[model samples]
Target: MKRISLFLLLSLLLGATVLYSQNPETNLRVVSVSPNAASLGTFGMIPTSNYVGQASLSIPVYEIDLDGKKFPITLSYHTDGTRVAQEATWVGLGWTLQAGGCVISVFGSNAKIYSANYYDIKGRVVKTVRSNLLGGYDITSTTYTF
Candidate 1:
């Protein structure tokens, strides 16, 4: 009787562990790509000291499909001279940032997008590229000098 009870208990614990490991909500899906700096070059304006070199860019909102339902993903960009940061959040899942550029975060069971920064001749960022949810790229342009 003791052997049978122990076997049953061990079996139950193993089964539960397997089920927990297979849960979809805990899995992380990340999507990232290389930056295409050649395609996005400077826009003809040279940098000057008199002009304030602070600018912001806009990243489009995206929707993610999870278990036959759609959830919205939003981005927030903080622009400050050379410290331009972006934060992406999804329906209360989580948020992440990396080195004042584009980053990826956990979004339940859906995919996460990463971002990269492009700089100008003065070593200031002029453009940024982030992967969209639909296998494409989203670009944001910023003018560092006025």
Candidate 2:
């Protein structure tokens, strides 16, 4: 009976590893913002001019030490440069990356799937993010150099 129980636990553990995504720290990378958002990231700037700056890349969730213990922090996943990343502090979890007018919600302990309209410089919806899956992990973040 002991052996059977141990085997079951090990199998469950392995299954979880196979299903979970990679660690966020290992995968985060910074990239350029969408061309339109690039122009808009800066507040009070010339509205009709091209803009550029370094933004923190958003990545998926993995175990990270925010306050000593391992916790999964889902961030605003983005490949382009991050013009803004407002940290949305969870009441009992980790900080959420809340930039780019994109958002995730925690309602009565349940997380809401994020949804919003995204546009390119040409004002077209180039990307769409809406999921029945309540939790989507963060992305790998990195910076680019000229």
Candidate 3:
């Protein structure tokens, strides 16, 4: 009985490991990187002199593959050229925000807040609050990043 239980446990663990490894969505990869590309603004907000700077090459474009969907993300850099924020359009009108290496917020076409993340002082995500169609909220402890 002990041998049988151990064998079943090991088999289940191995199968779970195989399934996790084969999931493509867990592997977020950058398809391409275009340096010095045009700015797409910050989190669907219009580009201003304070955000995008004066030059056109202030933002860099990164095409990423997320769950078989391709999204072109524009990265905004600070004055020192360090990456500060990232923005990407969702579907056709919605937009997503990635700050501090984590997706912090998402907004819909009508400027509705779909999801927002709370982060710790170390810039790590603590939880995500998502709005559902039922007019309620779903809070989760999962974090997604590029």
Candidate 4:
């Protein structure tokens, strides 16, 4: 009986190891957002646009895979009545994975501003940065924490 139990345990352990080895250690998530209200603004300017009123805006949400590269692959989805924008003038454009975290970007068409969110390994947002058309104004590099 003891020998039979040991053999069964070893077989189970080996089978589990084989199953685990077949999958890669990677986590991929797609994020989307849209603005609830927006205002007119200029390029290279800080976002200070006032919301005219509460209204539904049709915006595109994209799923992007950066793979730690400079450029990203973004897939867009058009849907109505999804109000999930970070700011009044910000619309989500794309996303990427960098430095053991996820970075989600938003674009302000009138303002020509780009904003990004940095998320940790646990998928919690650690920091956010906003920049202008020239990739300036408030963009900064940060280190990811576990």
Candidate 5:
């Protein structure tokens, strides 16, 4: 009886651990800059995007720069597409800034997105690590990225 109880407890603990780690509310932010130092080149503008995933759902938001204005985009979840959200809701009004690169946000964590990236101005991946997240739990992450 003692051995059986111990085995059952270990099995339950392992299952719980697997579920928590497998389906975590992970968020990823990407930032890249141009090699040129003159101006915001055609593809030099460092766009911002995020993927808030909880359980099996996801909510992705991307901001594309045009001329001197920033466009707000909110794409919904999709299962067929490779990049998740295909249909989106465009709201041309939102807060955006381009200090060193085009800034974009989804929740309220600007520093999280900015600091999560490991790439520098040369577009090369550097060291990357973070202690904790800068946003809340997203319960609507229908789609996710690997």
Candidate 6:
């Protein structure tokens, strides 16, 4: 009787664990950032940045340079893709700075954002991890609904 009970308990626990980790459905989408200096060269702009993911998502980060114009950046998310995992970064300088972007991991039918960060550019002096730059914002992680 004792052996039978223990076996049953173990089996149940294993099943639950599997279901939770491999949930067939979820409503989370992750976003992320990665800065590619090559974007500058590719775009023929000396200070542009870009990020590309394994899942066909691309982000081009444009920096406001000597021209003194602040550009608006837009981001979008889609749910129909089979793979939703992504890593992104927004980077610029007069100084050096780094931060996380939105990132998502997907299971068979479920998705969750494991990490995210966003930067707001304002003011004349942007304080970064190393030095003060022309303009910058704090990096923060916020939540969203899918």
The C-alpha RMSD in Å for every predicted model, in order, reads: 22.1, 23.2, 17.3, 20.0, 18.3, 19.2
Give the range of the ten consecutive residues with the poorest summed lDDT in model 5.
Answer: 137-146
TM-score of each: 0.18, 0.17, 0.18, 0.18, 0.19, 0.17
After TM-score superposition, what is the CA distance of residue 118 in candidate 4 from its true location, in Å?
11
- Give model 5 RMSD, 1 decimal: 18.3
Candidate 1's residue-wise lDDT over 1-146, tens digit each? Answer: 99999999999988886464342332223333222211111111322232566343334477668799876544423233221332223321121112123332222322222354433333344333332222332222222211
Clashing pairs in 4: 34-85
Model 4 lDDT per residue over 74-145, tens place: 322222223465243332432211222233343322232235544443334544442122223222332221
lDDT at position 112, candidate 3? 29
Which should have the higher lDDT, number 3 or number 5? 3
Model 6, span 1-146: residue lDDT tens? 99999999999998886464442332235443223322222222222323432222335455444478655343322222222432232442211121222333222222222232222232233234343232233333343312
Weakest lDDT window of 10 consecutive positions for candidate 6: 92-101
Best by TM-score: 5
Q: State the C-alpha lDDT per candidate.
A: 0.34, 0.38, 0.37, 0.34, 0.35, 0.34
Candidate 6, residue 107: lDDT? 28
**Candidate 2 local lDDT, residue 100:** 29
Q: What's model 3's lDDT at 83?
A: 47
lDDT tens readout by residue for model 3, 11-90: 99988864643412222232322222112233223433645563332343567787998766554432323244433234
Identify the runs in model 1 with alpha carbons over 4 angstroms from their true place: 21-146
lDDT of 5 by residue, 1-146 (tens): 99999999999998886463343434444333322211222123333234532122224466778898976554222222223422222321122222334432223223333334353333344444332233232222221111
Error of 2 at 39 (Å): 16
